[model samples]
Target: MSVKHDWYQSEAKVVITVLLRNAAEKHYAVEISGQRVHMTADDYELDLLLLHPIVPERSSHKAYSTKVEITLAKETGVRWEALEKPAAAAAAAAPPKAQAKNWDKLVSEEEKVEEKEAKGEAALNNLFKKIYSSSSPEVQKAMNKSFSESGGTVLSTNWGEVSKEKVTVKPPEGTEFREWDK
Candidate 1:
C-alpha cells in the first residue's frame, strides 16, 4: 500500500512542533512558523522544522528529534521617519571647522627658535660678566679654568662661587705674639 502526502499540511501560518532528544533520551519541544506550503522530507533535520516552501513530493512524516532550529521573519526597529524633533535638531547642528594643516607645526618651530635665541643671549651675557668682574685674580683664574675646560665661552658657574668674598686673617683678642714674647 502507498501513502499520499499533502503539501498544504506544511503551509504558512501553520505551527510545527519539533522534539529534541539527547543521549539521555530526554525530549524538548519547540514550535516554528511554517509560512510556505511546499516542504520535502530532506528539508527537515534532527529537531529542525522547515518553515519555508520546499520541493514537491517530499514526505511530511519525517522525524526530527535531535536539535530544534527555527527561523523567523526579520523585524524592522525604530523607523527614522518617525523620529521626534529633538533627534533631528541635534543632527542638524553645525559641525566644527577643519584645522589648518601646518598651523601647529609652524607655531612649535617658532617657539623653539625663540627659546634657543634667548638662551644664547643669556649665555653670552654671563660669559662677559665673568671675564670682566672685579673679583680677585685667584677667583678669576678659577673661572677661566672652568670655562676653558668646558670648551665653550659661556660661563655656567653658580653665583655663590663667583660672588663669594675672600677670607682675611685677624689677631686673637689679648694674644698678640709680638707683645707677649717681650
Candidate 2:
C-alpha cells in the first residue's frame, strides 16, 4: 500500500506525518542521518532527502493509531522552503530570461503619473509646505513670516531678504485685502 505523507515546519523544527492504516503496529523502522530520513514497514516505504541537515540525535518519531508523527530538529535556525530538495526546486520555478526595458513606454508612464498629480492652488501650497518642512530653521522662520504677513500671496525661503523688510499684504490682481471686524 502507498503510504501518504505530509510535512510542516517552524523556525526550529519540522514535523513529518505519515498516514498508515495500522500505525499502532510495531513493524515500522525509522532511520535518520545528517540530511536523510528513511522509514520502512510491511507495505510502506518512505525515503526523503532533506533540504537541510538535521540533528540526527535530536530527531524522533511516535506512532499512534491514525498516523505516525516524525519530528526533526534543524541543525541551524534557517527558514526551510520545503521538506525535500526536489520539492524546493519544484516550488521555485525556473527564472525568465533578462531583457532590456522599453524606455519610451516607461517615460510615458512616468509623465502620466506626474499629470495625475494636483496642479492647482493645493499643489502650490503642498510644494511650499514640503520646502518649509525640509529647510533650515532660518528658512522656516522666513517662510512662516512671509506667508502669514503677505495675506497668503507670497511665500519666501530666503531668511536674509525676508528679515530685512516687513512683508506687506499683496493680494492677487482684482482681489483686495481687507481687515476682519474686531
Candidate 3:
C-alpha cells in the first residue's frame, strides 16, 4: 500500500499528516533533522527536505490508529514560500539523475525537437521588434497601415538625391565642344 501525506503551515509550526491506515506505534520510525524528515514502516518510506530551516529539537510526532501526525517548529515563525525547490533545479543540483524521471524521453521526442525550433523562431521575432522600433515615423506609419489591412509586402521610398541631368562646362564663346581622346 502507498502512503499519502498532507502538509499544513501555521504561525509557528508546520504540520504533516501521513496516512498509514491501521498502523501501530511500534511499526513506524520517524527521524527529523535540521531540514530533513524521514519516516519509514514495513511497507513504505517517506523522505522530505523542507523548504525552510526548522528546529529539530521542537519537532515531534505521534502515531494514531489510522495516521501519523508530525509537527515541526519553524525557525523564524514565518510561512514557507514554497514546499520545495523545482524538480529541475533539485535534479540538477543533486549528484544523480536517477532520482528524477527522464520525462522528455518518456513523452514524445518529436515535441522536444519542436520546442527547440520554437526558440529560434522566438529570437527572430525579437529581432523584428527591434527593427520595427528603430524605424522612422513615416516607415512606422506605413508598416502599421499595411499590417491593419489584409497584407503588406513591400516598402518603397526615395532614399537618395533626386535624379537630374549631368552638368557640363560651357565651351568658350564661339568654340565648339571637342571630344578629347586619351
Q: Pick the candidate with the highest TM-score.
A: 3
For residues 88-128, write the lDDT of model 1, one tens digit per residue: 44345333211213445888788567556766777666556
Better of 1 and 2 by lDDT: 2
TM of each candidate vs. truth: 0.17, 0.47, 0.47
Q: Considering lDDT, which of the candidate structures 1 and 3 is the better prediction for this target?
A: 3
For model 1 the local lDDT of residue 150 reads: 40
**Most accurate candidate by lDDT:** 2
| lDDT values, one for every candidate | 0.36, 0.78, 0.66
The collision pairs in model 1 are 12-34, 12-35, 38-54, 47-67
Q: TM-score order of candidates, best first? A: 3, 2, 1
TM-score, structure 1 vs. true: 0.17
TM-score of 2: 0.47
lDDT of 3 by residue, 26-122 (tens): 3888899887777788876776666788899999999888899999999997777654455664554433211323445766576555545766768
Task: Give the backbone clash total of model 3.
Answer: 0
Q: How many times do residue backbones clash in model 2?
A: 0
